[model samples]
Target: MIERRLFEFHFANGDKNGVYHAVYAYRNPDGGFGHGMEPDTASPESQPLFSIMALETLDEVGYLTKEIILNDFMPYFQSVTTEKGGIPWMFRPKSDYPCEGHFKTVKEWAALSTTAPLLGILEKYEIDIPWMKKAEQFVWSEFERIKDKHVFCYLCVPRWLTFLKYTKNQDKAEETINNLKKWILVDGIVCKDKADEGWGLYGKPHSLNYATSPESILHSLFNKETITSDLKELVNKQKDDGRWDTWYGISEGTKLEWAGIQTLWALKVLNNYGEIEK
Candidate 1:
């Protein structure tokens, strides 16, 4: 239902309300979202990861309003937030529904990987609420702590990039991007060649996965040839059934759900780079 609505919204001149309705079905009474909205876990309990997916969907459909941010999202985040004012990647699932083992093993501590992206979403929408300041503080501290590290987690790089992309502190953001460049493609943080593997959920992080759009600050890290090749690689990955597949999922249901999500993502990326008509 969600995937079909997303397809229609993007490609078939469909109504955004349909997408909103389907996504809202996952909203918990606590104002957070769950029930496997992310596809990697089927836990019905409200989780930070699921809420991130939910917010991303809402943002895509232009349904993320200031009211939604202040009333629905902030309260839920406050309830789950750590003392450091950041949310954990996952909370221990209260229900026994299927969940990946890695998600089950997470400790209830603040994680920049999850928190930074949420902040990025808020930044992108220019939505400022009281809770955002604390999140920003925590994310900045994490960035400072990790800047000198020899390597970075592949997953965190894009989230951090998203935060930097929309962050108000352009000077600091530029400095951080420059500092991180040495480790980005050089330390194998991002995949420059097509053969690099095992560095991401499905494979190594493609150049497109980092830069996302031509205007993104991360685009400076890749050459024209690299982006062009990665674009071709992305286009070739689509299956005969007109959907993209995910290599990481704990269940058959999860795989199918992720396929739909990935298909939507692929279409958006192609359209962003003008590989296809929007």
Candidate 2:
């Protein structure tokens, strides 16, 4: 019932209050959220990665107000952002906090995964702060720098596309998307050895389609047939208990949070595709 209520309030009723209560439990006192909201990292300390999740959730619920963005969230982000204006992948608390084994951040480096979604959140809320302009620069530069490289990041693609989708710079957005397509499709990252292989964009759990709901820009990279197939896969993965299982092995408490998050994502994808009654 709790999971149903959470999904229905978020997907059908547009209930900001319900979503807020669900999200706020993880918020830290310092205005960022980190208390294992990600399930991989169990620290109450504010993390850029988890903060992006919280902000994106708020935006999804239409609760990302200017006041909250500028006053509450931006300050913590400003404190953590690199001199180059890009936020790090994470900033773990110095104090003793619960952390999974092998927990680490990029440490003094900007990460596209964290920075792009944060940019998307700012764009969604229409907050044109000065830092955003700098972040925009970083996103493009990083895209160009890594586009031709042998490496690719499936997790960051959706987030980067989200930022591009709402970006005011249409020309730049188009250019960046073109580059991404080359890296993902033309360069063989989408289906490297075979479909569903390691790091191939679509096959993995929480892949591009799973992360990016109502995926429009990526239609070229992932065809309608593929999208439909992936959608069916998502449906098939739902458990008998009505919650989708997470791929991670974590503590029981964090496991519950991760399952809830994954369930929310699955419902969002279903609701986006007309599978849920609006």
Candidate 3:
């Protein structure tokens, strides 16, 4: 059960029809139980950012069984779909071109969504396994092209583990485990400050544009997992107040929603280490 304070945005104004008079765009059309706030740009919900962030939350807080979905999330993606069904970027759709998300094919699309992660952590949650062979084949093949980018972050772990788990590819799993360290900002994550004036595959971080890139994302990625003393140092920095400002600025505006999102994201890493959940 979620605290009412955190959940009222969806239930507070809901009608007898089960629809909330308020609009949470990422929500199912009926305005049923879901994880995001209103999706109207004028409101705090402009970015469909919460869609994945929410899935990540549900991923952590043991709520995905009830929240998260393709139907509910697809409208946002549908706005961007180019063909029968394809998601270029998980956030920006094909229509937002130049501003569109990357990964041109449907296989690429699944990599961007929780589809990969959910499947990876499935057995951990006691979920089913179907068509795993095809799923594993697709993700590993695609990672070779985008491993340097955040796109890789979404699927690398899952794909690597998939090969190890289903295909019994120990050699490949070892390779993935080796590279997993590099993916972590072990130090920090780097993102450009603003949207580029011209088009590119993805966007960059805002604050650290001038000083020189530091390790924010990787550091954050490993923040909850103390496999190394460096990660323990970073996670320990969480304020007594129970928050860590992705302060280096990789997630500036996102700080507003960072508390819940990062808290849960951090927990995932920690859980990976067999540490007890806080």
Pairs clashing in candidate 2?
A: none
Tens digit per residue, CA lDDT, model 1, 40-153: 677888888778777777787888887787787878888888889899988878778887887778898998878988888788878877888888899889888867453345
**Which segments of model 1 are wrong by more than 4 Å?**
123-128, 148-155, 192-203
Question: What's the lDDT for all of these models?
Answer: 0.79, 0.70, 0.37
- Candidate that beats the other on lDDT, 2 or 3, i.e. the better one: 2
**Candidate 3: tens digits of C-alpha lDDT, residues 1-278:** 12222233232542222211222333444322233241112122223333444444444334454223444543453353333232232333233222211212323344423334433544444444343445445556655665655523332333334334443455875575556555534334433222332111113321211111123223334332223443354356456876644432113444435444445434444444444343
- The 10-residue segment with the lowest total lDDT in model 1: 194-203
Query: Top model by TM-score, which number?
Result: 1
What's the lDDT of the predicted structure labeled candidate 2?
Answer: 0.70
RMSD of each: 2.6, 3.6, 10.3
* Reference-based TM-score of each model: 0.88, 0.81, 0.43
Give the clash count for model 3: 18
User: Model 1 misses residue 259 by how many Å?
Assistant: 1.9
- What is the Cα-based TM-score of model 1? 0.88
Better TM-score candidate (1, 3)? 1
Candidate 1: pairs in clash: none
